[model samples]
Target: MLVALRKIIRHFKGDEDGVALVEVAMVTPFVLLLAAGVFEFSNMLNTRMLLDAGVKDAARYMARCSSDWDTCSGYAKNLAVNGAISGGSARVTGWTTGEVTVSKSLSTPAIDSGTGTELYLSSTANVDVVQVSTSYPYAGVGFWSYLGFGQISLSVFHQERVLGW
Candidate 1:
């Protein structure tokens, strides 16, 4: 009985017939997960780049405008959306026009006093510096949602020395 048991154990340990199959079974899931992670990361990078480009374009437009804050804000939003739309066919399905927000404010260094209201370029308060900021909500992709990452809020702001208008 002992000899038979030893022979069985040796046979099982030396058997190579199904070894490859077992190795593949163990490694396949990890390889698939790695591929999925790469895809998700690339998608996120592309989306962020598009959003940043949009914000930068909008900021440049706002810097050159001598219009009221409200009007400039509208223009900035439009420019940002258009920029994002132009980047690629991939669109954030949950995103909307209302999701984009534009704001104008004095530069932080210039507002060191932290006293009184910050001035926009349209205001006559010796506006030496102005910053244009835009924010958008990135609802993330299905994979991200599955991983419980949920939504990621993204914002971009540009500051330009108020060039002589």
Candidate 2:
């Protein structure tokens, strides 16, 4: 039995016929995992970019509008979610107006908080800044959980200098 096992081992050592196949079989899972990682990373990057752009756009819109604070904030949230103040398709799947948060600073424009309803402050901590933020749960191709990375939430915000009209 020992001699037979040695013969099998020696045969395998000299047999180069399936060497490439064996190497590929050994490395395929790792290569596949690498590819999946790249794909998932790209998706996350794209989602993050969309979130940033949306928040920035919303902040810009909010900064210029001198309308009612609640109304303006609503429009800003709509714009952030739909890319249009009026209405449009959401930038990301499962994204809604609920995820969007539009807020204003209290000390910006050197105005008093008691001035009027037009400047109803939403965040005193972010004074001198107009903030648009959102938190979206990233819905990947489900490979993240398979890889033991349960879930990911893309939380993003953009602040703009207060320049209200």
lDDT of 2 at 86: 83
**Model 2: lDDT of residue 49:** 96
Cα lDDT tens digits, model 2, 1-165, are: 999999999989967898899999999999998998899899899989988889999999998888888988999998988899987888877888899988876565433547644433444433467888999888775776875786788999988877674
Q: Looking at model 2, which ten-residue stretch has the lowest summed lDDT? A: 117-126
lDDT by residue (tens digit), candidate 1, 77-124: 666666432343324444444656555444334333567554343444
lDDT of 2 at 53: 87
Number of the predicted model whose lDDT against the real structure is largest:
2
What's the TM-score of every candidate structure?
0.68, 0.82
Segments of candidate 2 deviating more than 4 angstroms: 108-128
TM accuracy, model 1: 0.68
lDDT of each: 0.64, 0.82
